[model samples]
Target: MSSISAHGLGGADDLPISGSLAIVGGTAALAISFVVLLLAWRQPRFGRAGHELAVPPPIARVLDGSWFRAGLRVMGIAFLAFMLWPALLGRNDLANPLLGVTYAWLWVGLVPLSLLFGPALRAMSPVRTLAELLDKGTGRSGGEGVVPYPAALGYWPAAIGLLTFVWLELISPSSTDVGVVRLWFAFYLAAMLLGWAVFGTTWIGRADPFEVYSTLVGRLSLWSRSASGRLVLVSPLRNLSRLRPEPGLVAVVAVLLGSTAYDSWSSSATWIRYVQSNEVDVTRLGTALMVVIILVVGTTFAVASMTTAVDTRRSARKELPRRLAHSLVPIIVGYMIAHYLTFLVEYGQQTLIQMSDPVGSGANLFGTADMEVNYWLSQNPTVLASIKVLAIVVGHVLGVMAAHDRAISLLPRRHHVVGQLALLAAMVGYTFMGLYLLFGS
Candidate 1:
């Protein structure tokens, strides 16, 4: 129940029950899914159904290993290094610059493409690679047409991670401790590998909790689309119909803010000087507000990106408006730019301020980051942060533009040329602006 102990206490004797339960549940789910899938594969009924499934043409397979695969590997390794060695390896805090960039691009741009083209992350998903390893190592295959349960239980791993993160922040906040976090990540990596044994590659594809929750929303609303088909962004409401900001995300943000608030409130000196130095308390309030804002904005961005990707994938028609056609890539890039801009603007200040005055004014901002942000900031400050932020922006733009181009090409020849040029020009202008703020200032 205690947050600190939730992730197995520093003392080997203190094991977290919640964490153990998650691992157990996840393992059980994978086992069941694997068994069922194996049975189906070996069974005549499943075998018959499997033969009826459509197969992709050879040409469609060639595009599988494009930039997406490379990008995923690069990001995964970068994240691994950053997480495993936050103190000596990565950005200013646990905020790995490369990972940040990837995240920005992925959510903004690649997600849309994945929806339109295919499962974007599958190409180089570390999870998938590990799953393949499991399949090969275990000598298991869908020989009879059984479903892959470990792959089916993909969400559990992420769920465990997310839950563990929130608990650490709110209940027993130890993410600030570098050694502890690394140990936790060790467990996380181990658990993820275990998950692969059940799910296989694209495990999350079969069971994304976000998508599942969205389906519920899709069915309830009068304006909701059938959960069966792809979503269209032509209408904003319809495009976003299934997206709901979950309370859990809010709770995560609340815990972060509340922890900071508790720190300030519990400090005798802080409260004593409250009336005399109102500005100090106000600053703490600002910090608290910032935490909540990050949670809300970050969660929203994540939801939007995932939903967009899913819808794009489901839709058979890839048509788009002349302006919006090539807009997907640029939109994602723009999102990355925006995402990093804020991160740089925030983290840069946090690091610099903390360094100059460790315990004076705003030290806690840098000092108290959970493993994710703290590790990156501590490891690589300016270079990683700047690059990551820039990458996110640039990646989003490229992805959006690429998607739009694909959509535009679907139009008549004359329309494609003119439309591409116009979109490119707009993207250039946006890029220029981003550059100016990033460097010109």
Candidate 2:
């Protein structure tokens, strides 16, 4: 029950498994994914057709009502107010709810919320709501930017923003400090508002890191608004095709996968011992390691996706990564769940308890401050380890399916089997790397 081990809650000390077990797990992860190449639907089912389930008329009315949206926005702002208060004026101590709220709840908690509800952050974004309010207050005309957002920039800003946010989470010594959180949010809010002003609202869509991330994961959510303005319930695979191809899309995914990988790496004893023994400043070294990991992940995928040795359209080599970028979402989200599930469940409770005493006045405004977090999951490493492995395998399977769909659509027919080699290798490497981090390190 110590924060000394992991990022979000008490450390994760996984029950050690034998080398043979790890090797078997890694091979199974690859075998399961590679199975997609043999039996994958060749016609691109997801890209062409989505299996939608009808919503009953009465239920649809409630879900699509204007009041529901407004209520969510109001709730988002209220939570924003709660966290902002502690960040600004509350005690700059662990008793302050800011640490738990930011790390445990907001970042890690966004995964499940998005998976179940779809773009939960955007629906409840205080910044998005505030931006809307600011624009309306000024009575804008058409809301076009003075300078149209460049087509070339795409989500690269979001990619950079993601890296910056994760940098704060991963490397900074003052990460949990109230002043640090305040300053970080201060810069974030100011930049968001100012960017919206000059570039119009497209700036926020392109540059808003958290929103982009939430929306990315939202693709896996069962509930989504279809083209005809109806809320449709669909399978996650059916919903996967909805991700629009955009510039920097691949890079954005690369950052997500690589950063999550490094976050796990940092918790390993290998990383811990190296940082402690090194003469170089730990912060700088940590930053380097993060950057390196991100680059390595991006490079691996890019090479694998582009290196297919087939006679095909000239642009296929260039566009392959972007075309298949959606495959990484499942993997990133899966790893996120694997890495932070215990942290979120345990520390999320801790956050709720802390929120009741936001000002550190010892007053339990919600009358639930006396709650004790269940640490049983943390103690039962065997069950936890099984869940983590299963999650990684599931993610790999999903990634393979997504990639297979894209490959059939994009690659030439003759190259389909042979062409998937690089991609399959990449998925196997990525999956095994995750397992290795979980088991070996």
Candidate 3:
């Protein structure tokens, strides 16, 4: 088996780390949180004061033009075509591009693309494109269907969908099978279309797992649609702050982090030995473990947010988790980058090469069949390890800033510093846990 086949869903193998560096990393993360609390902006700055950088008039016009949007829809159709081609007739092994397309390309490829381009996958989602076409064909306005969406549902559906996808990837024994993945996509398509039919485009955004995932990461992108619906560049933090606080916001964030941590943990030899020693069904055990991790992590953050003093009504206090949830987005993105950077670089290339000969007929359609994937990052374990640690630390710093800014905006003046302590501690613990996953995975 190839290194990627083992580490594709898992993380990089055997990263070297110094004990001193790990300690320094943990210390720096906590110290920076305190420093930000003590000396950062007292007034709520990020609340409504995001700076927007202007694009040239022509560029803006071109970006917002119909041609660009149609092109994106075309891209969505093209991906669907790729899926149908191999999904129906391609070989069953890793040699077929279907497996790589699902795992390496789409699963891991979403991170950087969302970060740089802001929900490109969502925009180019084939299911979404088809839904829009259906809506237009039916002559609906504002993409609303016969029935309105249930406001109470919010992102809860998307949260569940995300968990389901992660469960299949991390827990299902047959996850690597091309046919299994194809069946998964088939179900995904049917579900997306059904939801889209019931609630329209709004439903797709709120209920589709990949759409929510991409849009969440897209919050970190430099480009975004402003209030007036024109695409413009803004500070990543400001973009992050603009996230719509909805039901299951914490649940979504928790699943992202917990499943990722579980992915790392599930790959360890220790976990293998534990499973081997037990007579419990692996699927049931793994499923239960993943759910427990998500609940524990999400509940921990929620409780930490409530630890601070609040003079507000109990209703407002109950909303604290949602208010503080945006603070964790950067940390999730950073950790995702930390965990998948090298894996994506290596296997992502391999996926591209496989794409050239998707059906195993030895066709060089994309002219990349002979390309060799570079392993320079793997060769220098120290550099890769350092990058992973630094990514976590930087994410920690940004998360602290977000939490601080959010506290000042919502918490009473007297509860400011003390209220943040619990959140700060949570950030510290989360960072340390992520570091341990890196060093030990």
Candidate 4:
């Protein structure tokens, strides 16, 4: 069987270090906790039940109507169109400008949205929605509830996706790979839909990793103070606003930011050739990167949970373990910053290409033909690529801090919004810069 078929989901051959790190960190924490429990066994304490994790709230009453649902349907069709675009018109005459917009919307745009909204994509998630439709058509409910709410799916799928994402970064990290990547995504979408066909969203939610993280974070956050200043931990940390960041976090974030700085200065031609060559199996590299990312992020979740647990026990007037469990959030956060920063760097160039020659792109049903505004803005002295690096750091801070209970409320809006706007603004600026380089009067 081919590598893709064998792996099913890419990144099956993940590096052992990731798992080792998780196990080692978890085991160490467990051991330390065990020792502490033994030491404090005789202390008189109130019996508090072991806390259960909290999941993201269900989609509250939508202020809008089926419009949101319709949009999801449109996205599904658009994704299908993008997958078939290259086949319809051979690569030579392909309308890149149009394709660029579609790619941007699906990736850059959707990423921040997903991160900020706690699996917001799941609501109108093209993949899930498509899966639901297919399940209905096939007369299969997949065994249970609708769309397996995030709580049901747990965190495995996301861990898989994160791992896959890292693998892609190391391997075919090119805009051209969009066609293949989109196709891969569609396949996963099909699988998810099939999952619904077999089990439904309710079941999937129980399996979603993000939901699991959310549950864990929310429950532990109960020690987190509420907006009213009382010990209400059900919600997020309201005061957890993004700060200037600690030095260690800054260093890690710098590495991530610096990755983009280097990429922006490199020729995309060089990077593309490296990936397509014999040295790298486009599939293998993709898988490896994905696993690497998941490990890093998963480790972060582990550390954060430990931190919350420590804080929670202390708040409850219990003798808590003093060990610094998995104090690796800085490293993990730094890597996440690097992963995302690299994407933005490459996107800067793609946006530029579209802005320089919109009409040379030909006509498309999507109206992405003349989206040169971004490229035009990129040329302005004020709209520096450096700003994008800064945004990465800011976004990381937002993502991490918002995970806390008392701090989450202060932000009000989801942190992902900040990242999304930063990316969009950067794209606009870069596109405009490219336009000037190509056709400045």
Instruction: Please report the candidate that would top TM-score against the real structure.
Output: 3
List candidate 2 stretches off by more than 4 Å.
Answer: 1-20, 141-143, 309-316
Total backbone collisions, model 2: 0
Clashing pairs in 3: none
The lDDT of model 2 is 0.80
> Number of clashing residue pairs in every model?
50, 0, 0, 67
Error of model 3, residue 150, in angstroms: 1.2
What local lDDT score does residue 409 receive in model 2, on the 0 to 100 scale? 74
Assess candidate 2 and give its TM-score to the true structure. 0.94
Ranked by lDDT from best down, the candidates are 2, 3, 1, 4
Give TM-scores for every candidate, taking all chains together and pairing residue i with residue i: 0.33, 0.94, 0.94, 0.46
Model 4 regions more than 4 Å off: 1-103, 111-120, 138-153, 173-179, 203-297, 300-361, 364-377, 380-386, 389-393, 396-441
Model 3, 57-123: lDDT tens digits are: 8998987788998899898898779767777888887777777677667777888889889988876
* Ranking of all predicted structures according to TM-score, beginning with the best and ending with the worst: 3, 2, 4, 1
Q: After superposition, how far is residue 218 of candidate 1 from its true place, in Å?
A: 16
Candidate 4 residue-wise lDDT at 331:
24
* Per-residue C-alpha lDDT of model 4 across residues 1-441, encoded as one tens digit per residue: 011101111110122233234323333443344334334433312112222233223432231247765786678667556545543443422244334443344433443443344334445545555556666776765645444444323344644543343234333545345455556556655655556654576534433323322322222222333334333223222212212122122222222322222222222334447766758665555445434433443343333333333124544212111111112222223223323333333453454444344444444445443443333322332333233323433333333333322222212333423322322232233222222211121
Q: Lowest summed-lDDT stretch of 10 residues in model 1?
A: 1-10
